[model samples]
Target: MSEADLIYTETLMQRGKESYTGKEIVILGGGDGGLLWELLKEKPKQVTMLE
Candidate 1:
């Protein structure tokens, strides 16, 4: 992944890590699936990808 990719993913994941647990998440425009992959590690209640 590119630096921007890492930065974007980590930045978002870190910010939401605590709040994501057992919560429903809606992801829009994460076509690469990187965000989804990381989000799953947090074990959220549900994940919906619009794209």
Candidate 2:
């Protein structure tokens, strides 16, 4: 998917926002992580890439 076309499933988005909250999130897969990394920039303390 293109950078602008990436979409997170509802559950993933909810969990990311709720459970993950302010914790660093480690993304296991690389495909979607790029886009996630960008979206997460707003909440820098809430996301990280592993692959």
Candidate 3:
């Protein structure tokens, strides 16, 4: 991935931190749990990822 892509990803992650804070998150089509792995970093209130 390019550096620009990495920056964009970080921006989105920060946005998620704001929007998903103190909320239950359900990630549909979380294939291979890749998204779950990223989310686990934040340690949100709750997360249920269905693949």
TM-score versus the correct structure, for each prediction: 0.76, 0.42, 0.55
After the best TM-score superposition of candidate 2, give how far the Cα of residue 3 lies from its true spot, in angstroms.
Answer: 12
Best-fitting candidate, scored by lDDT: 1
Ranking by TM-score: 1, 3, 2
Candidate 3 or 2, higher lDDT? 3
Q: Give the per-residue lDDT of model 2 (tens digit) for 1-51.
A: 553444443335554565444666666664655547554644646665566
lDDT of 3 by residue, 1-51 (tens): 456654654564575456555667887886555556666666778999776
Off by over 4 Å in 1: none
For lDDT, candidate 1 versus 3, the one ahead is 1
Candidate 1 per-residue lDDT, tens place, 1-51, comes to 788997889897786446688999999898799999888888899999999
Q: How many backbone clashes does candidate 1 have?
A: 0
Error of 1 at 18 (Å): 3.8
- Clash pairs, candidate 2, are none
| Cand. 3 Cα-lDDT | 0.65
